[model samples]
Target chain A: MSHMQWQGYLRKDGRKGIRNYITVVYLVECAHHVAREITSRFKEHPVQLIGFAGCYPNAYADRVMNSLCTHPNVGAVLLISLGCESFDRKKLEENIRQSGRPVNSIVIQEAGGTRKAINDGVRWVDWCSGIIGNTMMVPMTVNDLVVGTVCGGSDATSGITANPAVGLAFNKLVANKGIAIFEETGEMIGLEEVMSSRAVNPQLAIELKKSVEKAARYYSAMGHGSFAPGNADGGLTTIEEKSMGAYCKSGDCQISGLIKPGDRPVQPGLYLMDVVPDGEPKFGFPNINDTVEIVEMISSGCHIILFTTGRGSVVGSAISPVIKICANPQTYRRMEEDMDINAGGILTGETTLRDTGEKIFEGILAVASGIPTCSEGLGHQEFMLSYKTFTPLGPGCLPV
Target chain B: MDKLIKIHSLDNVMIVTADIQAGEHLHIRRTEYYFDKPVGIGHKVAAQFIESGGKIIKYGVPIGSATEDIQMGGHVHLHNMKSDYIPTYTYEKQYPGDANPSLTNQSINQVL
Candidate 1:
């Protein structure tokens, strides 16, 4: 048995954070440039940039932004408004203040134009960073952790190595009373029956099956499949084949519940995030790219993300750190600097699945204890947000 | 060690663990076969003869259907295999990736 513990910043809402970051948010696309300038000034500090791109109001965007601003890892928040956007900045600032984090806002149109607003934002971020530096540190156990897994740029070696290895680590985390989430319903088309069979109850199983069906219907309506051409170039023939590889990241643990984006898990176990848009397909696609899914995971309170890649994706989240596990030996050789673990060793007969899984589990603890991931050190903070709609989950969806 | 891997016991297809050349010989599960076409590292090869329109099994489940008859050790890909659940969209038809004039434009209205 390995006895590993981490030191986390304790928040007022009884949650612990692995990374203490001051987040700078833009309410709409117009404020994005100002927010970027403010964040760029703090190059040496733990600051992140995130925002919504739409000027139109969306209930789902409001919920997700609120959840992100008050996320456990975020120590303070700065909202940049263009003086005329539909996102509710007042309510967002109020919620952050209620969570005991310093909150400030600057409207570029009202604050004497561009240069003046940038100066004011810089001063506020400096003050906020100073206050967050003094927060009390608490001993955090595995039970207090919520980890998420997502696969991008997948190929054949993903199923044989990295995905199953992640599943093993997920099983270990859940066995230790920790939360593990595996998302991307659009990528899980054909594995619904097999996945639902592992649900803790029949009601939960029904919800699981329906979610995948919803994704299939939505993508079919879009006139394109969830799979990208990169998947084909990497040798994945069909959606079912990709789903089979992606499903292995869920491990063999019995799924406890289902939740949509921004819905926190009430219990410690395995859960699936339904990334598909509910009702009619209003949005162009459920997830525009990998960063959108990463943002959704952070909004659900994940402290860390396990990202498996075979074709090599180099993206990190705005709040949570993404641990890259490369599944292809050739890709790993070409991009070793971007990967944290070489699961491709399994294909080379250099390591076993259990060993690679244990390595990932250890990597989680190291990152939770303040070790910067490759993406983080390399300055890969990719952020994206778009319009999405969801009717609240059903009662049977979350029994815990 | 085997150069190809059968992901499940019931799978009749094997994933090539490394790039294989034409006229290469492979022995799997006490049976031997010869490849007539080059196969990429991550592509699939038939473990047994698959008749046209038959299901291709992998991970103990059907991934797609064979569009044409495939002999043992034959390379399986988009040219001979296709999805059974939904139409697999390619970049050539969806985007301006290539100038393959044979491809037709697909409308979202038609799919809906």
Candidate 2:
């Protein structure tokens, strides 16, 4: 038996959470500042601010909110409504109530505007913080966790070291009966056939291919692939090269299913998140930035995200923690404080890839046991969600 | 110990583990080699003669194809290779270097 042991906040919905966060949600862009103010004063607590800035209603936004508010990691949520927006706070409150979480709503217009709203929201947070501390802690194992992996700011070294190490860790996670998800189909353009070959079924293989093909078409019509100027500077020549590097993070595990953003996995195994928006190029770049991708993973119930970077990234999610794995030795040295694992040690031959993978697997357990990740310690709860379109997956999307 | 690695036996390039200066001497696959042009760490150096339009293999897969003939030990980058997939994007503006040029300091790395 494994020596590692930890307890998790067992939710009424039967899911376990590594972190219990109190989130202040803004229903529209108008209430964003007030929500921020309410969360700001409660800095000592794990209170995060999240919201949709759209005044206009969106089915996608509604789905994202329903999943995020009741995310296993979230213990309580306070909705801030501007009172004039189309977002249905009552529906959201009902969703939270059904999930068996304490939820409250504050309307800026009805709560005497910004000053009074912030004051009222703060009081509720203060009151709820006391009661939420009593959440039952249950013994949990790796099987109770859902982890996601994504790579960003990649350089040539990424594929050779950190990403492959992550792949090894993902394989370990799957072996231990944990759920592992890898995303960024936009970056997997050149490896569709090879990627889909690992799918458990022919139907899922076809869906994987279609998702990558969709990403290729979306970026092609957008006038550029997801490759960036920094990639060029980091010795990555083209999108295919970057894709090859990014693909290493998925490891060699069999893909159990394909899913769009805001969709949850039904079983414990490896999954692929098709983050690219469906249909013709419509809502701008599929993801305007990295936080959008992080938000999507968090909404899909990822308890923690494995983030690999060669150039180094500093951001974490609002509810879940982000573990940064640095791919380059020089980049790791340059940004030591920000990195959680120095997979770059593989580049200098100081450590083997499997050793780094072992370190990362331990790191995940450590963070899940309430040890603060570097991002969480630095207070990097970055969150961003934007407009995008994704038609539901076909019936054959998930494997039997 | 060698200052670079070929990653795979079939790879046509070596990944430099240490920054190589123009006058530096190194050993690749136990053969003595000299660097005539500098290459930064994590950058690629041709492991063998690569003809124009020939694929550059790494991790036993084709990352890209050479745009021009590259001699053994030559630096391989955007100047000499192109992706087999879609065209990569680039900003038209020239920016200064060395202070972190990717995303803002407070922002997460945004690459896909």
Candidate 3:
């Protein structure tokens, strides 16, 4: 019952990715510059620089870093370590190797100095790049891909048009056995019940409801609500109203599980990513901005993010492809060059929601098949890492 | 003849979709209104008279509250409307008075 189709890179772990890339991950803030330098040394290489600047340890951060290091798109990893930090680099390398990908780590403190680290990193990356194309390519299909969606700077038109249109694509993806994920409980406050009713089971429905409620309570105590200021200018009055509009981006997929940041979906179905932290809010808000959400989704194994916006955002992630789905007709007309899909046509009477949804669906396949998005071509390689903590999901959270 | 402007079907209030000068005919969701004054974009006017402290409902939600009674088709905005939540102030009125009670030392101590 689905028209969506895809061709992706078959990875060693059996997961299919829309991109096949070699990632250079810096383990600490001190080594980031050198790591970036090494990646830049290979100008034409399909290499991306992603890292965390925090030296302090966080279980949540560790998990996210590990997931990204082993994501399916990655053929190899070159880790730059400061050696003194408690990042558990050895364990992370082991995890990546376990996924059957080529991985190497160079501790800056142990590898002589900055110049030496860069030299060693470049050598390792060169070696990995040599073997990247050697990996046998297997046939990949839409059922093997996993995708996520998030909307930022939403206006009134976003809810009525693009958000629901994304939901349509989400439903199509899920029906075809591809894993679909949606997040930002801060934006899902008022629609918790409506969202829960679409879950695959009663248990997941309960977890879905509890997660958004938790986010609402957390943001309420912070004084500034999760409702963004731009939302008000665009005709949204309150958090609940904004939430109702924001929730439409998920479409009508039956949520199969509730996941936390960096937690991979166990099977190919719809999942609600619980982005809010558990226990007392300690390490600031769960996500500082839009890029943080993109990073979280990528860290959870998404190959690309279907980012919908009404007010416009120009950010693109360092690791995965981002398809900017413009929602507002006026904003789209103004920023057409930056957008990947113009869902605003729905409002112009030029196209139906289904037509816009199909366009986004086809855009996803094209990007997966090696066609670059506007952000990817413009070199908008932005990265952000923030601190947060969470309790591991209990038995009730993930059910088979 | 005119097209009806509607805020929400469940709402008692409806906004003028277009500019309406005084004495102009207005129809909203089948209800007619003869405006007593002009109304601009994002401004609200009642199809009938509304009382003070009444809820300014839109989309079946409370947007804010009216501060004074006004006739049908009269302009509704900041002058005659106020938020239901605690009043917020800008830098101009930093001092405590009946105009701003939440900033008083009494309230501060109570909060502490």
Candidate 4:
């Protein structure tokens, strides 16, 4: 048996972070350049840039941004405000400070323009990085880890290899008392029955079913299904077909609860993140792209994300590391450096499902223990946040 | 050891594990059929004859229904198979069937 443990940064809020990063957040699109400049100036430092682009106020955006800024992985925050946007910079800074992380805000207009704001932001980041470098590290067990799985650019091999392998790893994590999450309700369209059947209780089953229905309705209102053209080229005949492959990432564990984006899991078990926005379909799509969903998973406090791809998606989130598991042997050969594991070995009969699954599980531990993922090493920190609306989860959503 | 993989025993389609050229003979479960068109890797090929509007079973679950009769060894994709839950978006505007009213209850009942 393989025995492994990780040392993570312990936050004052009692949460453990696998990475200590100084996050520079842009409150609006106008402040993006300044925030980017601040983080870019300290290229050698472990700093990440995240932000919202909309000028209009959104409760969902506010909640997600707050969760991200105060994420355990983030040791400090530098919020760049355009001074006129509706993103509540004061509330964001206050929340970060309350989480016991060093936080500072620079308003571009108030600081006498772009040059002054950028200069001020750079100084704040430098100071924050110094403080983060001195943060204490504590020994963390597997139970302290919260891992999330997402499948992007999927093909037939995904269902046969990587997705099921992820499911196996998820099962192992859940068995070890670690939190496991699988999101993309829009992608889980036809697997509602299979998914609901794995719920811990009948009420959660209903909620699971309703969540998928909401996704179907939401996509229908947008005049398109969530199925992309690349999915078709990848041999996924329908959204349901793609969903069956995507559903395998959840493994065979009973789902403990349901949560919308930004809602943290209260217990160590499997949870389904309802990515579809609540109420009418005002936003174009629940998740505009794969990175948006990744952002939501990060907001939910995932220490690391297991990203499976068949058509090859090379992406990493700002706040969390992404472990890429390539499902297609051909894709793996083409992008070996970008993938962390080659699950396609199962299709080639060179390895069994259990072997690949264990590899993915081990890969997770390695990443949490301070190993940089292929995406991280390649500098693929892709961040995106959009406007949306969501109603708070009902009491029944989490029975435990 | 075949290039096509049957994900579930009950699935009526098999996914091509590698690119197959036209006229290539595929052997599955002691049965052999010749491919009439090039099938790319990750694409689906019919395991048995499927009638028009019949459900296409993959992973032992219904992914969609056949728009036309598909012979054994025929390619199964958007050109022939379509979603039963929601209208599948295709480049060309074609069938616009009403959403299946029984989808919700039927899917739940089947799994339960």
The candidate maximizing TM-score is 2
Local lDDT at B44 for model 2: 83
Local accuracy of candidate 4 as per-residue lDDT tens digits, A1-400: 3356768899998999999989898988999998898889988889889899999999999999999988889999888999999988888888888899998889999999999998998888877766777888988888999999998887768887899889889989999999999987777876777678888988988898888877767766777646677878878877678888888788877899999889999699999999888888787777878999999998998989999999999998898999999998889999999999999987786776788889999998999989999999998889999988889896678755
Give the candidates in order of TM-score, highest first. Answer: 2, 1, 4, 3
Best by DockQ: 4
Per-residue lDDT over A1-400 for candidate 3, one digit per residue giving the tens place of the 0 to 100 score: 2334445666777787667678888888999989999999986878989898888888888999888888887878889998988888999999999988888989898899899999999998888888888776656666777789998886666765677778778878878788888998877765665577878888777788788767866676565545555654444544444565566667665778888889888688888888888988887777888899998888888888999998888778877899999977789889888889887776665676678888887887778777899999888778777788888875556655
Clashing pairs in 4: none
Q: How accurate is candidate 2 locally (lDDT)?
A: 0.84
Error of 4 at A166 (Å): 1.3
Candidate 1 residue runs with Cα over 4 Å from true position? A1-3, A226-239, B1-15, B20-40, B43-112
What share of the reference contacts survives in each candidate?
Answer: 0.49, 0.49, 0.00, 0.59
In model 2, state the lDDT of residue B19.
77
Ranking by DockQ: 4, 1, 2, 3
Q: Candidate 2 — which pairs collide?
A: none
Candidate ranking (lDDT, best to worst):
1, 4, 2, 3
Tens-digit per-residue lDDT, A254-332, candidate 1 = 9999999999996999999998989998978889899899989889889999999989998888899999999998899
**Every model's TM-score on chain B:** 0.72, 0.72, 0.61, 0.73
Which ranges in model 3 have alpha carbons more than 4 Å from their true place? Answer: A1-7, A226-239, B1-112
Off by over 4 Å in 4: A226-240, B1-16, B19-112
DockQ in order: 0.27, 0.24, 0.07, 0.32
Query: lDDT at A394 for candidate 3?
Result: 57
lDDT for residue A46 in candidate 4, whole number 0-100: 92
